[model samples]
Target: MTAETNEVKQTTKGADAVDEAIAQGIDFDGSPIPPAKLELYHKVMALEANRQRSGVSNTMRSRIVRIGAKHIPQAELDKMLIDAGFAPLKDKEAAFFYGGK
Candidate 1:
């Protein structure tokens, strides 16, 4: 391919990973992300950005628990939390997040 056909690509690392993915039109799995999906994502994120700020640490913890539970085992996640100087999961959180398993 010539220079005209070569598009500059962003490195999918660090804080700008999502932006890089959007610019490249590809997901981490190497599959092309649909433009419509990207559009909707941008729309929702724009709304989120404009939303009122609460506790930033609270938000981070909530997100970690919500997404982490999906990928990490209960014991492992508890260990990670404690290792990171955060409290381990509460009873209610354990029930809600790890209930099925």
Candidate 2:
């Protein structure tokens, strides 16, 4: 805390918001504002927060699963992909993901 930098904008008070978050075992990375303390918005924010914290890209397997679960027929799936700018795998099977993983 002794170390000082140009970037650290000092608050009016000696303490900062980070102090409170740390007290609550939270990590705050400024992003889209949380919707509200309301139950539904809180749930939405929790899901968003988890997704952001994971820092993982959606995988081809997951996408394929989602597509299959939708129960769209093959022809419709093909057209949807095309419309969404997805193309077939260049050298592999004809499945996986929205954008043709």
Q: Please report, in order, the local distance difference test score of every candidate based on alpha carbons.
A: 0.81, 0.46
Candidate 2: regions farther than 4 A off: 1-66, 89-101
lDDT of 2 by residue, 1-101 (tens): 33332223332234366554433333344222333434465567679767743322335433653555356655566666556566633322344333353
In Å, residue 49's CA in model 1 sits off its true spot by 0.7
Location of the lowest summed lDDT over 10 successive residues in candidate 2: 4-13
**Candidate 1 lDDT, 1-101, residue by residue in tens:** 44423332334556677787787788765678998998998899999999998787778778788889998999999999889877789999999999988
lDDT of 2: 0.46
**Residue 21 alpha-carbon offset, candidate 1, angstroms:** 1.4
Candidate 2 residue-wise lDDT at 76 = 69
User: TM per model?
Assistant: 0.57, 0.26
Shift in Å, residue 84, candidate 1: 6.3
Estimate the overall C-alpha local distance difference test score of candidate 1: 0.81
**Angstrom error at residue 51, model 1:** 1.1
